[model samples]
Target: MIRTDDTRYALRPGVTCLTVPGGAVLLNPPHNEKLAGLTPAQSQALKTLNQGPATASALAAESDSVTTLLDRLAGAGWLEVTVRDGDRDLYTLRPFSTPPARPSTGDGPRTVLSKFTVIHRDPDGLVLEHPTSWCDFRVHDPRLLALAAGADPTELGLPESLSARIAADLRWGGFTADPAAEDLDFTTRSWSAPDLWFHRRSTLGSRTVTWDNFGPTAWAKDEFPQRPAHRPAYPGAPIALTAPDLGALRATDPALTAVLEDRRSCRSFDDARPITLTQLAELLYRSARTRSVETSPDGAELPSRPYPSGGGVHELELYPVVRTVEGLAAGMYHYDSFEHALRLVAPADSIAVQRLLRTTTATLANGAEPQLLLLISARAGRVMWSYKSVAYANILKHVGVLMQTLYLTATAMRLGVVAQGFSDTAAFTAATGADELEECNVGSMILGTPGDRPRTTD
Candidate 1:
């Protein structure tokens, strides 16, 4: 949850709402407006009721005469009886607390200590206890604590006695642990390129025990592939296209032109009609498979195509999530652009395809069963071999360019196209079998027949 200076609460993306104290309840009139006249006694009663539900007799003890004030506040539209328990009138505060303040920190901080677990393990086996949730220890920093309390830890730093006292207070206050040795076993493992360490501890009877220093080891060196063993093997048969296809695609219909001109990012799709295999084949051929090859004067090979890729590396590969395409079984298939055919990776009904597509925002906006989805992945080292830090950006640019081509082509072919930016990168890489390579997800585009025309801001 990100907090703002104004004390407004934001729990997650697109979810912003007012937060009140635990016991306090919010009350607002049918229409929002200021309460015209609220007496001091009435206001005090409301504040007291905010602590918890209370009867007039209970409220009267906390504040002034509850009956007179409660009646006045209710008449003034400042308070409402939220619930009735026995004879007590539970009044809710009329206006909610102000929006939370903007958070001073953005993106917050990375976890310093992670996956902390207490385990009782003997040579025989191990039993895991409650896993410690990652907590920010920076709050225990003397400097920060002092600042929070409107004092200066720095000034006290020179005085050893005062500093020790403050440290003691902080330790006992649950902000930090008391200075002691903790007994722990450190285990490290490699996840992706980074090595992760897990700290294990066991309590023996009641005696306090501690281990020496325990922390993550220096990051292990990344072992990247020297070269990619796999190469695109061109198909023996020529990718076929017909004259009627070109004519039908070239026809100028506003909707069709919008599809062509609209490029990628079609949020609304028509699910009534099934996308034909011919249309799917056309899209796959244009975006995934190579259209033509060119040779330089020196005899170096080049691709003649609709997209501009860095160094003509053609690092991008397509994985299709086939949901409701005619003549195609539902499954997760890797488009063998070289073979010009779909290689079944997992059954369409298999959870693997659902899991992979679930990682994408497209699945949320459009239903999980879109007509077709194109998962674009890149061979990292393939592009990185020619480009360095810029490789990441270059590969993404290549995806964008290719998506534009795909969108335009889909539009011309009277199909819906949506480019999705939000996806679970790690999941995508794993599903596409590109996680091992420096390979990463470039982007994803969902296509189907156009449904309802989307409402446009422009």
Candidate 2:
């Protein structure tokens, strides 16, 4: 709600003006909106504003057409508005999406801070942000911050008119709300602010203010290069996994329908005859081995595997924490999907590995640690490099798909398989000595030779 007589305007950051065949086009990055097919005069006016902030009166002599163009651009949220007093600054309104509707004059509704409004330090400075807000406030004056903090004009010893204007602008910007008219519907009531905030930010909609792979855009890669397709094999003696024979399996393996029906989460493992290395190798080969690697147009290596992954970016890696495997000594081993091999990560008696196994055992009433505790870790940057907002959601989805693949494969092999409901990422980081942000456990499962006891759901 900028005053026409006292406000200054400037082009919003990340906006680029490009000359076209007939005119010029104004591009807004990290958003889908753009001002395409602009006239030459409109471009010139934008260039003038690009030089720095200038009042409408200062640009009035250019032409009547330029003034109208400037007004249109300002209304379109392409220009940031700053309310000034004398030569000193007040505050600036930076629009991340479409600008909020203008505030109505005269006595307005009583307003309080919006529940979703969050004040934090960004790359710029301390600022106010609402999860679904169209614009945010950049406080240049401490008085403005005070108003946001719910201080009265008299408490700050400020002029009533100035405070009123700032308050009206804040209310209109969606940072403040009328308590009587606040949304308290069933959905809003059921959701916490952070949960709702995460939901809105992760999924794409007309209200999305951040960038994503909407058009399968690789904007993230343009800024930061994508991480390598495969994490370098861990330094150790690589044990090659035995790739199962499909031709022989056609005659020997159980039917797919029977396998699906027989898939039960078995908590008890046959400790007397623990799972062998060959069996573990075959299971990994059938479920998680990388089939082939393809290159994207942008030269990124996209690997194909037994399970479907978002964008064929198989960022999930498997680590088998062996406690009772027959041939494979009690140790944590990284399953090199690309090489169809296991690389030792930690030795038989590693503290972190033992703690992970002990925790698994404690979850079951009368069960020992499974012969194999396969931890599925995700390389976050792999998916994040090519996508935004949906990176984490996609990773979780990949874990589910991979889990199903493992379950069915294990069932067919007549082995015990159970997907763990939770995993301690901190313990996992301790075991692998990897950055939690870079690589962390998203899912885990237990696999071993099923015990003779009757299968009962735990």
Candidate 3:
């Protein structure tokens, strides 16, 4: 018998035994091996026997009178039984011991200290360096100490006597020890040395003042206070371009009113059920695509829609990740709004769909996947070349209008809807193959069957 901590044992050919805590042993049988000699009743009885020690009467009761074969096997010496008090079955087997301990190295104490070095310095005295760690130390000339104290030295917590000493020395003469000293040491010995003195220039000549002892009396009160609070002044006059409240606009336009009343962020969805192809077509047609073409006197064509864009560019493009839409393959498809059709872009597995949706939004409940995921991208350069700031703001406003349209349509159809804006922008851009020019992601939406609707109260 092998006796060691964390040891492996072969129970049979290609089979092994694993010992766990509390002296419990687990038999891991091989795929090809089977208990060929034992009958079904005997096999079931053995399984019960291995659970714990038990008397013959107790074993029969527990195994439903299936222990007759167990007694026969024990008489044949194939199985060893040990009798104990009170209702426990015991099996005799060889015992094992614990392993020995290993030696260890006994090294003395150690510590880690942070370090910093000056990397660059400008003529204006602005210094830049990559510190090993951030510290609460001020870097300033000694002459400025007195002025800094008057402002708010309580925040810095340096003693008043130290500030006065630095001010008197720097303003009157300068550093007394050596004017050419480049490296200043501030160790415990140097701080306590009697040689440390301040040299000053009087009207007569130079003079020196010596102190009995000079070092930090106690730990400097280094709990620096935060800066005073401030609040920006409010503008006295009204500003233009502020968004109108949705409730106010709803009273005039019935379409906008429908959207404002029905919009909600839904999560739970019905898995087996999905939206029909006809419903998908209607959603795409209403939110995007050209419903009717209008011709100008100069023969210029324009799409009839409420969503406004800069110079009627209509640069937003849509991509759909279809997982459970009826009559549609489970994969990614680009929505050609102009053509009013879905063009198959690539085949995506369930894992890929989960990854894409997780990066963009929260997971759907009950492992319920979305029927359709909409990706909106903007052709920025097309609009930016003609209109600058107007193009940027117009693109975002168009997305908002599109979301409202989707919400109202989904509500009318009794379907779930969600708009997600927090996404891995770079990953989505790469996956869509829309990186030509400056294509930017605008928004995303998930649509599926609504599981349960909350009851309305009067």
**The candidate that achieves the highest TM-score relative to the unseen native structure:** 2
User: What is the TM-score of candidate 1?
Assistant: 0.45
Per-residue CA lDDT of model 1 for 125-164, tens digit only, reads: 3322222211112121224334333343335443454344
Error of 1 at 50 (Å): 75
Model 3 stretches astray by more than 4 angstroms: 1-259, 292-302, 350-354, 360-363, 366-368, 453-458
Candidate ranking (TM-score, best to worst): 2, 1, 3
- Candidate 2 weakest ten by summed lDDT: 206-215
**Against the hidden reference, what TM-scores do the models get?**
0.45, 0.74, 0.41
**Residue 449 error, candidate 2, Å:** 3.9
Predicted structure 1: clash tally: 29
Model 2 stretches with alpha carbons more than 4 Å out: 1-6, 10-53, 56-79, 84-90, 96-115, 118-127, 139-170, 176-186, 189-194, 207-216, 220-225, 261-273, 295-299, 358-368, 450-458
Better of 1 and 2 by lDDT: 2
Model 2, position 225: C-alpha lDDT score: 80
In terms of lDDT, model 1 sits at 0.48
- Better model by lDDT, 2 or 3? 2
> Distance from true position, residue 91, model 1, in Å?
63
Candidate 3 minimal-lDDT segment of 10 residues: 199-208
